[model samples]
Target: MATDSQLATWEVFIQSKPGANYIHAGSVHASDKQMALQNARDTYTRRGEGTSIWAVPTSEIAASNPDDNDMFFDPANDKMYRMPTFYVMPEGAKAI
Candidate 1:
């Protein structure tokens, strides 16, 4: 059996309402999926602030390095044509 210090870390996400996007809430440490889920709910939803909770293992998440921001995101900066700035609105057209 794994000790408390050796337990896996799970990232927690909370949904405030139905059909709303889940936002990163925090993390919890647990030995298994069920434990992780329960820990997340108990830790983050004590005030009934969340409608739903998702607990994902920390090892399963992939993230980009902050140092690579220019190389990874700079290509989109020069593509001004991708934006719809030149379209003329029709007369009496409702705002979209």
Candidate 2:
């Protein structure tokens, strides 16, 4: 039950290259998916900056509450195997 004045918010993601990750570019307000895609392109990719674009409705996104960050992320801190501190790098390995 939305009015014409109350456009839905859409989150825009842009990929710079074919194999690169899609990064959050910005957002736009539109009534439908097609409009959202066009608005996102016009608003964020004017310079041909993106190889691909994705426009997702803001209402569809689910996010963790910041207030629960400690409880949510605490388990990972105790998992030592998650970190690579014990791994010895081979000689001449530049960035591993």
RMSD of each: 5.2, 4.0
Q: What is the alpha-carbon lDDT for the whole of candidate 2?
A: 0.91
TM-score of 2: 0.77
Local accuracy of candidate 2 as per-residue lDDT tens digits, 1-96? 756476889999999989778999988999999999999999999998998999999989998999999999988988999998897888997656
Local distance difference test values of all predictions, in order: 0.91, 0.91
Report the lDDT of model 1 for residue 85.
76
lDDT of 1 at 29: 92
- Best candidate according to TM-score: 2
Residue lDDT tens for model 1, 2-93: 56675889999999999778999989999999999899989999998899999999999998999999999998899999878789888896
TM-score of each candidate structure, all chains considered together: 0.74, 0.77
Candidate 1 deviant stretches above 4 angstroms: 1-6, 78-80, 84-96
Weakest lDDT window of 10 consecutive positions for candidate 1? 1-10
